[model samples]
Target chain A: MLTGMTAKEVAKMVKNKEDLFILDVRNQSDYQDWKIEGEKVSSINVPYFDLLDGVEGVLKQLPTDNKLLVVCAKEGSSKFVAEQLVEAGLQDVSYLEGGMKSWSEHLEQVLVYADEQLKVYQYLRMGKGCLSYMVISGEEALVVDPSRFTDVYMEAAKQEGAKITHIVDSHLHADHISGGKTLADQTGAAYYMMKSEGAVFDFMPFEEHDRIRFAHVDLRVLAVKTPGHTPGSVSFFVNDKLLFSGDTIFVGGLGRPDLGGKVQEWAKDLYDTVYEKIAAMADDVIVLPGHYANLDQEVNAAGYVGAELGAIRAGNELMNQQDKQAFVDQVVANAQTETPPNFEEIIAINRGVDVASPERQQELEIGPNRCALHHTH
Target chain B: MTSNKFLDAKGLACPMPIVRTKKAMNEMEANQVLEIHVTDKGFKNDLTAWTKSTGNELVKAEEEGDVLKFWIKKGE
Candidate 1:
């Protein structure tokens, strides 16, 4: 019998510096578009159809020294191929459990907080810097900043024995399509965003200082108006413990304020939010940001992509810059002119003004996320 | 039975089949049936719910091997 390895398991092996020979049986086009990327693992693309006639010819070419990992679109082809390889007298062989589909959609959920009353799971979207949160309080849960893969959140909520009660978007996202509306519609949860965002869709608009309460959960999420990344951006402070800083402040630095075409104005707002509002917050408060530039560096030992506000403030020089004019100048100077890929289309989709096919949305969000500030200083 | 339009959404993932179906239905006349073929396993539930919400009529849905075939009649 061939062993089945999940995408996460394979990722761990690669991280551990294990040599892996990944044989991808997906079609050439898909191989060209996107495939598993790892530091030590090497991959070879051979469409499963090519091996339909017989595996004898292909078997001779595969390396027997390293562990062979077979992968296909979903699992059927990869399993078939792995079985054939095992029958061919290969000593070690395994196939990806759900194949490339699972690999592409793999999400690593790390528990960020756990206490007597509440637990929070941060779903880290590997490769992409997008972060979604599930706050489980008793039998109720609230999802924050959900991506289009609603099933992940739904399943996570189910596993926690909680029903999704509310969905919230920090702002009108331009980097990726917001799943808030779709998820809310599916779960009958009240979807929320800042009323000032001018979203065409129907949602319960929340203002600053509004507390979102879940039934039977001793938790209250306070909406804090940040308004730096976008005019209506707001951060969620959960029970005064963790702050969901959505695109307003990242671990590396603050979110680039120039995405809205008003760099100077937005930069000023960002500076105020950073120096004025965020400065007043307790240093011990954990800051769970919306995006991270480098997962390898940003993710802490706890596996969550965040740190204490004191650490973030101490690490980021921009946070300590008291000169408001100089801060604005530096931010404006460091602002990137190149916009995120398909940002306009993504914004339109988030606003409920337009819709994109799944394939199109995937293509739009295929590249590395450029939502965070890349400037070192 | 004849259909007004045919959409082959096979091998496509979620929201693609629905997005294409919406576009095709927009160009179609009321009461015209749009035939769609898809391979994504989730499309069965997705399409059923989509049609219900949009007021379209799912005349027939049959599975032949791996492909799911659906005929949706446009609503006014």
Candidate 2:
């Protein structure tokens, strides 16, 4: 979807260039098999296959100028990188028309990699009728909005041979008592919550763009200032690739906003977050959302857990609405208005004040807290 | 030339007119004068800074009705 050049035009450039920089963003194995063999062609192994986990450091390594030619195995990955570079105000950027596959066929080029390695994990976590995750790197891992059952985290740590060094609450969760504080206490990890939560609930605070270091790994958990589901609601971003969308954004859907009084304001924030912030990233990002709304259906299924960031951009039918005004109108016209009476109780649980006894923690989290958008029938 | 290449940059957002004018100048010959029109209250100061940066000559800059026009020469 880039403008100004076609496949044949780029092919011509690769053939005749005396000095040009060709960058391959594919894994090392693909690079070793076939690549455009002319001038100074280099490959950086940024393996974000199946899931988009780490790419921030890779983006920093790219040159801002001098006719950068980006290539990948298929055009999908490299095209995504080129668009991101353009957004960052880089000039003279273009991706190979058909990625390496086409280049290998047409240019008869050789792909070479010093060492080709890719890490792909299909299922992050699966428990008794629940799917959760402990995203880790090196000696540190983050336990996100965990259920009261604390053993899940410990077991995950035991499996990975890493310590749970950080506990993050996506939002003031109502589905279950947040295990953030408990996990922090046991592991001696810091409990991180959005700064906005200070006004809504008196608790330890963190602000936007705050970088929390865990062991040798630096996990910059961004507090995306999203309000409305509750005024203090926030989402977490790790390395700008994985968006731990609490209740605000779901896979193929959005968070229920009736928890707080400002239904109008909440809808507005959701609009800005979806269209402005989330939409601005590369298409290949992996979106790991907070909740999957499949509990009510008879079939009972896994929530829309993770999705390709590209698929959302090409597919979000509702993102075209121009501004905050149109977004509120659209949400009000099509949102569920029911809220739970026990929402305050749930908020207390999220605040860690209404914490359950060791034996009763498992019973409190029946479903998500009954809030304004979701209710107990 | 009478600086007849008029650019109506009135009401356009910041840096847009400058970016467009830069593009236009890149395609035009040096010494071709460009007449730029802008309505933003800040355009007077914006044009001053831009001309200084690009080393272009601002021949005449003033307000007419709701728009401000700046006649700039492409300095060789």
Q: Which candidate has the highest lDDT of all?
A: 1
Question: Candidate 2 docking: what grade?
Answer: incorrect
- Per-residue error (Å), model 1, residue A136: 1.5
**DockQ of every candidate structure:** 0.03, 0.01
How many pairs collide in each candidate, listed in order? 0, 12
Off by over 4 Å in 2: A1-131, A198-204, A215-218, A222-232, A295-304, A358-360, A367-377, B1-76
Best by TM-score: 1
Model 1 clash pairs? none
Per-residue lDDT tens digits of candidate 2, residues A1-377? 24333445554554344345666665454454334544444445543231133345555666665577776644665676667666666677887775543442221111111111211111221111123446666656667676555675776676767778777776766544566777777887767787565324333566643676544444554344554234434666655556666665555556666455566776777777777677777776666655443322211122224666676545555665456787677676666655433456656867755655653443233222233223111
- Using Cα atoms with residue i matched to residue i, what is each candidate's TM-score against the true structure? 0.67, 0.48
Score candidate 1 by DockQ: 0.03
**Chain A alone, TM-score per model:** 0.78, 0.57
**Candidate 1 falls in which docking quality class?**
incorrect
Instruction: Provide the global lDDT of candidate 1 against the true structure.
Output: 0.77
